[model samples]
Structures are given as C-alpha cells and as structure tokens.
Target chain A: MAKRGMLIVLSGPSGVGKGTVRKAIFDQGGNDFQYSISMTTRKPREGEVNGEDYYFVSKEEFEHNIETGQMLEYAKYVDNYYGTPLKYVNETLDRGKDVFLEIEVNGALQVRKRLPEGVFVFLTPPDLMKLKQRIINRGTEDMETINKRMTKAVEEIRMMQDYDFAVVNDKVENAVESIKTIIKSERFRVERVFPEYEEMLGDK
Target chain B: MAKRGMLIVLSGPSGVGKGTVRKAIFDQGGNDFQYSISMTTRKPREGEVNGEDYYFVSKEEFEHNIETGQMLEYAKYVDNYYGTPLKYVNETLDRGKDVFLEIEVNGALQVRKRLPEGVFVFLTPPDLMKLKQRIINRGTEDMETINKRMTKAVEEIRMMQDYDFAVVNDKVENAVESIKTIIKSERFRVERVFPEYEEMLGDK
Candidate 1:
C-alpha cells in the first residue's frame, strides 16, 4: 500500500518572510508536494491568476462552500471571504503527495482542530527589531500601520507556543533549509509513516 | 544577559547507531557544547576511564546519590546501577553550554517530565531488518540474546510516539547532519531563546 502524505501548516507573523521562504522551498523543486490554493472572494490584483494564485470565486460560491462543509475553515476579512477547501487537501494527501498550507495563526489553529494529525510549524523573526525593520522595509505601510502590525506580531509570536516546530527567520537561506530539514525529519516519525507495522507482523 | 543553553535528550533503540552519530556530532567540533557523562556503578571495561567514558562510582556512592536526589534517574541491570547526574547537566546549561545526553527511552522520558523544557529526539534504525543485522554484527551476545534484544527493540520503537523529533539512522553522515540541523533549528525556538522579547514587552 502507498504511504500517506503529511499535512504541513505554516504560520508566522506578517513580514517574517514566510512567502519568500515558502517560495524558496518550491523553487528548490518541492513540486511533488501540493501547495494549497485557498479560495477567496476578494478580487485578484494585478498578475494574480484565478485558480492558480487563488481560487477566485464570487461571494455566493464561497458561502455555498461554507454551507456544505466543503470549506475547512473560513473567515471574512475586509468584507471579503477567504477559506481552505477540504476536498483538494484530502485528495492530494490520498495520492501520497504532501500538502503545504500557508495561513495565519488563527486559521492554522482552526485547521489543526479539524485535522489533528497535521504538522504545525511557526516561523519567527530573529528579534523584534528585525521584524519591525522588515515591515518598514516593505515601503508599503506607513509608520502608524507598521506600529499596528508590530503590535499584532507580538501577539502572534506569543501564540507560537501552540506550534509543533518553530523555525527562526534569521536568514532566508537558513530558514528555508531549516523548513526543508523539518519536513524530512517529520517524515520519519514512526507512528505517522509506519502505522501498519504491527498489523503487518500480525498477518505474518 | 547571555542566552540560556538548551538541554537536549537523545534516545533510541539499541544498535541504531545513535552513539556513532553522536560521536560524529562531537568529532565535527559540536562538542563545544556539553555531553553529559552519566554516572554508573558498573566496573570499567578495558581501556575505559573513570570520568571520561563514565563517572564510575561504587555501589555505595550510587545509592547515596539516589538517596540525596542527586541522580535524575537510575536503573539497575546486571547488578550495576547507571543513571544521569542532575548537577552536571544543570550546571552546564547554567553556563550557557548546550547539554546533550544520549540515554535510553525511559531515562529520556523521566528527564522530559522533570525538565519539561528539554528537547527530546528519538533516533531510529533504517528498518527492522537493518536493526536485526546491526545487533548481530555487534557479536557481543548469542542468538538467543539477539532475538531478545530485537523483541525489546520493537517495543522501544513503538514508544517513538513519545519523542518530539525522530531521525532515521540510514547512514552515519546523514543522521549526524539531520541531528545537527535539528539542534541548530531548535536554537531558534521563540520560547527557549526569545523570552527576553516577552519581558521587554512586559508580557509573561
């Protein structure tokens, strides 16, 4: 029988470069795994593709998924709906392909409650000063917004206690390598990878 | 204030090459960190030093340590006592040096319950066939003893669920590298290494 794939949830504070680190993982040829594309009611910005970047759907379609329990977890933000689809994740795992879901702490927690066997990893900046610098360096938000984000970052970092593994984003290369190592190491977890060992022995 | 060192406990079944992998970690200059030298009442074998391989002590001294609560956990086998010393491990951590202890699963579990913050890693053989072969290659025991050891090994492998991390011992180099990655990555855990940020923000 084919082995089951692992469900990995990645969460971190904003501006911690989770996107960059995740991109590096994919760029390093992690295409065998499925990157979960979330469904959102928000309109796509420039260069965003429907069903590729995100499953762009109307508010009605999003609500329909919610009603049918098709959406694993959903929440409204800035009057737009965003959620994970249970079908795609389960299907990918059934095919023995690992799945990666990048989401916020709250969403990750919700997904954990739904999929208790999921692997939860929290990424953190080296320090608060570096986190603030990264946020400001983006050149997108003003000082007031940056302060708000920093406040939120502190709260999110506190929630890191819930994660199974924590990776520090001191350097992009190091952080990406750590994440890859974590993926490989977790794959060897005896219970997850060899659950049928006892049954196999019993059959013998 | 200087950062506190992490107490890492490594455990695995016998003949999993955990000792070889651990020696590689030290040989690669990772021994700048502390390796806890366990105290044992067992008489030194050929070429073994009193304090280098182990803190060899008399049975009276070992019993005294157990009475005084100096020993973290101790077990008796073949009419000899073997155990970890709390003072050495705690002192090393207080000095800001990472302390690595290669112990059996029971000792690791005891330390985990007592320390609660120490890292626990379980090293596993590549597979059952390799594990049996490694035991046979040791040539220290008869076939009957080898079969008994393999049965014990299966029981120990079942307890892998209790470990925080698992590394497969397929190759010495790969196992050592994976363990090094785990240690380096764990150094970034927010709670263990970043408690000051919480203090700076006045959050517990």
Candidate 2:
C-alpha cells in the first residue's frame, strides 16, 4: 500500500522570510511538494496569475464556497476574503504529494481546528530587531507600520505553543533544510506509517 | 540559555541490526549523543570495557538501585539484571547532550512509562524472512532458539504502536540516517524549543 501524504501548515509573521525559505525549498526541488493554492476574493495584482497566485474569485463565489463548506478554513482581512479550498489539499494528498499551506497564524489556527492531524510549523525571525529591519528593508511600509508589525510579531511568537515546530529563519537555506528534514522524518511517525505494517509484517 | 537534551529510546527485536545502526551514527560523529550505559549483573565479555560497554555490577547493587528507584528501568532477563541508571541519563541530559538507550521492547516500554517525554523509536527488519535469516546467520543460536526468536520478533513488531517512530533496518546507513533525522527534527519541537524563544524575543 502507498503511504498517504502529509499536510504541512506553515505560518509566520510578516517579514520572517517565509516566502524566501519556501521558494528556496522549491528551487532545491522539495520532493513531492504541492503548494495549496488559496482562494481569495481580493483582486489579483498586476502580473499575478489567477490560479497560480490565488484562485481569484468574486465575493459571491467565495461566499458561496464558504456556505457550501468547500473552504477548509477562511477568514476576512480588511475587505477581502481568503481561504484554503478543501478539494485541492485532499486531492493532492490522495495523489501522495505533500501539501504545504502558507497561511497566517489565525488561518493556521483554523486549519488546526479543522484538521488536527496536519503538521503545524511556525517560522520566526532570529530576533525582533531583525524582523523590524526586514520590514524596513521592504520600503513599502512606514515606521509606524513596522513598529506595529514588530509588536504583532512578538504576540505571534507568544503563540508558538500552538505549533508543532518552531523554526528560526535566520538563513533561508538552513530553514528550508530544517523543514525538509522535518517532513522526511514525519513520514516515519507511527501513526502515519502503521497502517501499511499490517501487510508488510510478512509473517502471516 | 541552551536547549535541554532529548531522551531517545531505541528498541528493536533481535537481529534487526539496531546495534549496527547505532554504531554507524556514532562513527559518523553523532556529536551530541551519549549512549546510556546500563548497569548489568551479567559478567561482561572478555574485550568489553567495564564503564564503556556495560556498568557491570553485582546482583546486590543492581537490586538495591532498583529498590531505591535509582534505576530508571530494569528487567531480569534470563537471571541477569539489566537496567538503565537514572543518574547517567539525568546528568547527561542536564549537560545538554542527547541520551540514547538501546534496549529491548519491554525495557523500552518501561522507560516510556516512566518518562513519557522521551522519544520512543522501534526498529524492525525489512521483512520477517530477512529477520529470520539474520537470526540464523548468527550461527550461535540453534534452530529451535531461532524459531522462538522469530515468533517473538513478530510479537514485538506488533507492539510498535507504543513507539513514536519506526525505522526499517534494511540498510545500516539508511537506518542511521533516519534515526538522526528524527532526533534533529525532535529538537525543533515546540515544547522543547519554546522556552528559548522568550529570551530570543529580545523584549524580555
């Protein structure tokens, strides 16, 4: 029997280099990884592909999916609705491909509530100052915004207890390696690997 | 503050190559690993060192430690007292070095019951046939003894649900790699790594 894939929920505060680490994993050919494309009511920015970046949909369609229970977990931020579609994750895992969900803390909590078996990993910056510096380097947000983000980052770090693993994103390559090791090792977990043992026992 | 070390309990049926895998890890410089030497009543082999191979002690001393709860876990196997001393494991972990216990299934279960936080790993051969063949290859055990061992091996594999991770000892190097990965990832566990986050947060 083929082993089923794992659902890895990756969450981090903004400016924690989650994007860069995730990209590095893909660049290094993260084996059997399928990033879950989220569905959003927000309009896609210029050069953003509809299905690639997000499943860009109208507010009516998004709300309909939420009502129909198609959304695994969804939340409204500001004026836009963002959520993970259940079908994509389920189908990917059915194909024996690991699904990576890069969502915020709140959405990750929701996923945890819904899919308790999912592996929850929280990425954190090396320190608050480094996080602040990274946000400043972006040049898109003002000082006030950066300060607010730093405070929120601390609060998020406080919620680390809810996660299964905490990864310090000091270096993108190292962080990616850690995550890959985690996933590879998780495959050996008794709960994940036990079902196939019945036939493989080879004694009967 | 430095991270506290982990207690990794490695257990396997006879002829599963547990010893080979363990030695391979050490040969590759398992820098943080400290094998927990068990106190035994049985006489050591001619070339076996006293403290290195086994802390060969008198039956009276081994029984006294068990009665005083100084032994973490003990078993009387074939009139020989074998048990892990609580002091060595505790002191080594206090020094921030991971302690590895290579014990049989029953002893591993006792450790799990005593220290629920310890990581339990079960090792098995690639198949029952291979396991029986390995037992026969020992050349010391007679046919009847080998048959009994094979039956016991099947029974032991059934108890694998009590373990956290299961490694198939198909190839010694691959088995060692799997165990190393498990320990490395277990270090990132939130419960183990969260306390350090408070100081790393930089606000406290």
DockQ agreement of candidate 1 with the native complex: 0.30
Tens digit per residue, CA lDDT, model 1, B70-160: 9877788789999999999878788788999998777887888888787778887677545545564767667786667568657865777
Q: How far is candidate 2 from the true structure (C-alpha RMSD, Å)?
A: 5.7
- Among incorrect, acceptable, medium and high, the docking class of model 2 is acceptable
Off by over 4 Å in 2: A128-154, A199-204, B1-3, B128-154, B198-203
Q: Write the per-residue lDDT of candidate 1 for residues A86-186, one digit (tens) a residue.
A: 99998888888899988877788899899978778888767764554556476766778667757876786678877877787889898877777767666
Per-residue C-alpha lDDT of model 2 across residues A1-204, encoded as one tens digit per residue: 356688998888767877788778777883777898889999889999988889999999999999999998889999999999999998888877889998888888899998888899989777753564566476776778777766776787787889999988878878988999899889899898776665545533
Q: Could you give candidate 2's per-residue lDDT for residues B1-204 as a string of tens digits?
A: 456689999988877777788778777883678888888999989899999989999999988898899988888889999889999998888888889999878889889988899999999767753554566476766778677856776686688889999998878888988999999999899888776656545532
List chain A TM-scores, every candidate, in order.
0.83, 0.82
Winning candidate number (DockQ): 2
lDDT of 1 at B204: 16
Of the candidates shown, which would achieve the greatest TM-score relative to the real structure?
Answer: 2
Each prediction's whole-model lDDT (CA)? 0.78, 0.83
| Predicted complexes: DockQ each | 0.30, 0.44
Model 1: lDDT equals: 0.78
